[model samples]
Target: MREDFLLLNPGPVPLAREVRTAMSEPMVSHRSAEFESVYERAQNSLDYIFERSSLDGTKTTSGGTSLVFNGTATMAMEAAVANLAGEGDEVVTVVNGKFGRRFKRIADRYANVTPVEFDWGHPVEPEAVAEAVSDDTKVVTMVHNETSTGLLNPVAEVGEIAEEHDAYFVVDGVTSLGGDEFLVDEWNVDVAVTDAQKCLAAPPGTSAMYATPRAQEAFDGEKAPFYEDLDWHLRKAESHQTPFTSAVPLFRGLAVAVENIEEEGMQERISRHRSQSRAFRAAFMAMGLSMFPEKNDESEYSNTLTAISLPAGVRENPDAFFDAVTDRSVSISGGQAHLGGEIFRVSNMGNLSSEQILRGVRAIGEAFHEAGEDVDLEAGMAAAREQLR
Candidate 1:
């Protein structure tokens, strides 16, 4: 990382050098025995990481499985929808943020998609989800942490509904897994999807989705469009392989990454993310910053990323603030598309230390000053430190 570039973005935040080095090894053939062994390790590692039945999800290590879909978090998503839902099958998708909306668009190509959209910063109601699950509801999807608006949806409740109705519960844990509290088996999720770039502390190309037995059962007989074919992937996945090749380096890198989490413990990592996130929020509140999500309790507050309403005038010219922070070597981002110019999303995914918190607050306070808003950097930083401590 350059002294001028500090990655505070929600995705692709910052990766440890060890994982990156593993990804930088010599390339090998997908069909090679060495590759199969490498593939098996990754599948096993991901199964544990995603909490896959203590022995589930795709155990495949072949082609690009390690990388989160060709450098974007979207591919893993496409894979999940295509592999799980079939043509004309109605899927109820929650659209509370950009990510959820993106899922809707992706589903439109393969299934009969029914979108349950809510206010930009609003949380999806469990009751609403229950009501939305019509008889034809074969699949239900939502982003646990809607990175677009930084809202967390109710996965547990949604999962329960899926259990009651026998529908597949597909959760986009892209911004939550590895950094937030998620239970694959206990939650009863059919297809739990996530990208390594977000909170897994891996590079952008690696993402994963854990399939419960029910999800696997649903995959059979339902032939999806080619490329997103779940059947083909599963056949290969069953043998700890893939239908196509994967980025070998991320496969290796992700294994090390998952090993790190295993050694440190998943709950411990969740606590770290929660603590840092709580501190970040408290500090923002003390500085008179307003949280967009409104409620942080059971609503959609995420520990990995939090969205805030940009202060007045700053939204008019976000660059002044963005540039000021960039000058300080901290990188934050605005929302996506329609919501972009109004909200600012701050992430503590990777490489965010308690020391970095001080620097981030200082940069934000200084930016407000540059934008002609009086601010107390010390007070914000102090509150943040206290929250962490």
Candidate 2:
């Protein structure tokens, strides 16, 4: 890889120098006082992010405990489900993208799942979600930002429906928590999970979740997997520790990453992400590319990433186009699952600057040209510049 190689994938974003340096610090025993201090720092910084993660300055959470997992967000997702619901319980999972479906699959292992399904790339309807949830529903799960389709779901609206039924609301805020607005208390989210990668801009391996008192009261350790029992995790968290061994280096990196978020301020970070996303969208539109997802009144495009439909010329030979991009020392992702080769995705997550985003736009435009497409590179650049300004 080139020294100047750029990573524009949605998760595992390019880390800042300070975060990388923190991970390289001398290893310490997971149970040692030194490690516990690291854990405490990470947890405290995380609490700051969780409590202040609002897009419009209208919502913030308080009094919730943030817990870390040695595994990724998927583990946290499973823990949220397993600890709350069990065999005869009904879990209402709102599915509009891959992550939402994953939540349903996890819920299936422990409870009877009621899936409120929608077409991929389409907005999830809160009314439909309300129809699915009832007083008997033990829990309701939703993905805040569907990374697969670049659509931000109506989490607050869906959360309201779950609240009406008095169901435990679990949200996978994997891509939205740190980059966009997430109102845990105002949205009535009982538990919310996020990965160290994604919006946190740290290395992979570790994840975190926040649990409210209501959710804590409902936790059943005996019903959960031994390693995922929230009751045990919470008990251990009082000492700033996990139930088992922890990822020391990843936790160190996460501590610094959240510290970076604190220094930059949540409002400014969210503004940067939103601005960069708009720039990418404007650039793609100017080059005659359309976004892959459609939005309703309750939904909007994701602020962390942009997914564009592949032009006929590029879609016919997607590999060559992506190869061209790779040759430029920049990396972006293609659509996953059935949408593969149909769309391409780029992320503005983490601490990306305007220049890097502009370069990514130019690379995509050049790739289109290589694929025999008549995209206006200058026009795309101009549009991106306008948005950045």
Candidate 3:
């Protein structure tokens, strides 16, 4: 409750005071031993948050490694495809939301991409993905959390299908990792990418990827140009260094963010997110606001964020709703692409508290009223409280 500003967006989430303080610490040379110590600590923390014992991508071992890139998660997504897909390699990409479409778009640039598309709010069916993957398919890409619509895709099932077809499974876990439940190796995912922002509650401009030995095999073929090359990353990772000048301050912030997560415990962190999401959804539903995502069950719903259809009156004057919310010192997100003005997203990611969510819901309810909508704020608050209780 900073009172000055509150972020409810999926990315660039509200950082903890400690994480922000870590970023303010004096910068160190990327090649210095001090930086190496920081790098080693970060890697160890990331492995724990990623639930991997090791970095080599094996689920059974505790010594797996993850690549920390000084860029957005989108860069990690691109790197995953660039290293795993090449000329004549068929890539089966699941497209159910904005991020999913992004994976397809990225894959299309380097491989024969077969996109299994769904509506913006609909979940990607694993059965359809199974049908899309062929013997010639070299990679399968998916977004674990469809952030745009707050829908969770069946990544575990799709991973099984990809493994059955002997294809490398790459996941865009930008918004899901650290906040949601994800098992990289158990799900047979060959590569999974996530950023320092979003669920990690750290500053942006830094991303990480967990790649297995099998996924690394794709680098044998035509590799991406120097910057996107995973081979160079792996070679440099041995010494806790990056091939290029690393974002030292970002590393410090991310390491502290991961430390905060460790202090809270992953299961407890995930549970908090789930409870807040459920409370928000329940409150909104009680206020007669429908969810934008077309989920068949709770499992298909995202715990990091919740997307709600725009109120009828607000849809006609969406800016009023957004502006009203912002005026209340709470910053949320609007729908993207074709869904713009049709829905609004509220994130409960990072270190948000029950009081914060309660206040956010009330503010949005007030915004609904400001937009000339008939919403029962009392009912919504009551419902949210019940869920939180």
Candidate 4:
């Protein structure tokens, strides 16, 4: 723990030194008023981050209040889904990546879930979303940025279409939000979900959603079982409390992370991500590797994760490739199931910079070299550094 490890994986990435220090802090009693103040400040600070871009929801809840922390982002997704869709109402689920498919699976467990799936590496078409909606449709769920493929579904367009159909629009912004632009209000997004892990640069365990008054009103119509109930969270959150104890260290880390993001300035932060991403892509291309996403649709590109397609006839070996990078003391991820072995997804968003990007490119070259492939790693490194410039 004395020396920092570079995290180029999709998540739980290398945090800023400050974040590590925050996480190093000792625990405080969850019930204490001082704890509530920390919780309250955290909530308010995040509201400023997610909602500040628009004139909407700025109330922050700390101590796992503004955000539902101490759990994976899955908890936020399930809570939002279970509360909004009800037992019998219908919803549209767009699946392109592993996470998207996972969301569909979560929905299938519920009563009236209709999945609108697209081919892997393909974006969800607006028409497909339109076709999936039915008279019974109560909600529309889609992943804003498909981390598995680095292809973004047009959540803004999808949001408009869903709203036009009078359906509640719920989006999973897990890997996209902080690194790029998102519209929770103008897009008329009733439910917006994201975790602090990826683009947020905060530690894991803190996940949150933006629930509009309309979304809240709909949830008010029925009683949710136990902790799945947003009403319970609302009731307790209004009083600055959570139904259970939370990860105090994680919250402290997030508080600092959010401040760091603000200090960097959102646009500049996004630009930095774009710069590193561009450089990373250039380096890959120099090595004859291509991204799963196409160029024209780069607007739909994800800033957090880049899914690189395997080189032709190379016979994909994600494990081998990832191991190459890890051998260099940094970590990059392989694709999840279905995409596994076919694509190597590298993370860019976070506290990472051009220096890490340089190191990462060199690692990939080392891997190619070990594989006995004739690769110009120097060229890849040069291209990457140039793009960063």
Measured against the true structure, the TM-scores of the candidates, in listed sequence, are: 0.90, 0.98, 0.95, 0.92
372 in model 2: Cα distance from truth in Å? Answer: 1.3
> Lowest lDDT 10-mer window, candidate 2?
290-299
Q: Rate the local accuracy (lDDT) of all candidates.
A: 0.73, 0.92, 0.85, 0.75
Q: Residues 83-160, candidate 1, lDDT per residue (tens digit)? A: 777777888888887788899999998899878888877778888888888767888887888888777778878888
Model 1: pairs clashing at backbone N, Cα or C within 3 Å: 63-245, 63-246, 64-246, 64-247, 67-205, 67-206, 68-205, 68-206, 68-207, 152-300
lDDT of 3 by residue, 307-345 (tens): 999977788889999999988999999999999999999
Considering lDDT, where higher is better, how would the candidates rank from best to worst? 2, 3, 4, 1
- Model 1 is weakest, by summed lDDT over 10 consecutive residues, at 59-68
* Prediction 3 global C-alpha lDDT: 0.85
lDDT of 1 at 244: 76
- Model 4, span 1-389: residue lDDT tens: 42656788788777888988988877888777866776677677666566643222232221222455557778788777888776687989998878888778777666488888888778778898888886578888888888878887788777888887899888898887677666676676887788888888888888877677788878742544466678877777675667778677887788788778777766676677888887887888888787876667567677667778766443445566667777778777776777667667788877787888898888878886765556778888889989888
- Each prediction's number of clashing residue pairs: 10, 0, 11, 7
Candidate 2 lDDT over 1-389, as tens digits, reads: 56689999988799998899999999899999999999999988899888898776554978889999999999999999999999999999999989999999999999999999998888888989989999999999999999999999888898999988899999999999888888888899999999999999999999999998899999998989989989999999999988899989999999999989988888898999889999999999899888897444323999999999998878889999999999888999999899999999999999999999999999999988988889999999999999999
Off by over 4 Å in 4: 53-65, 221-223, 293-295, 312-318
Better of 1 and 4 by lDDT: 4
CA shift at 101, candidate 2, in angstroms?
0.7
Error of 4 at 227 (Å): 1.7
Model 2 steric clash pairs: none
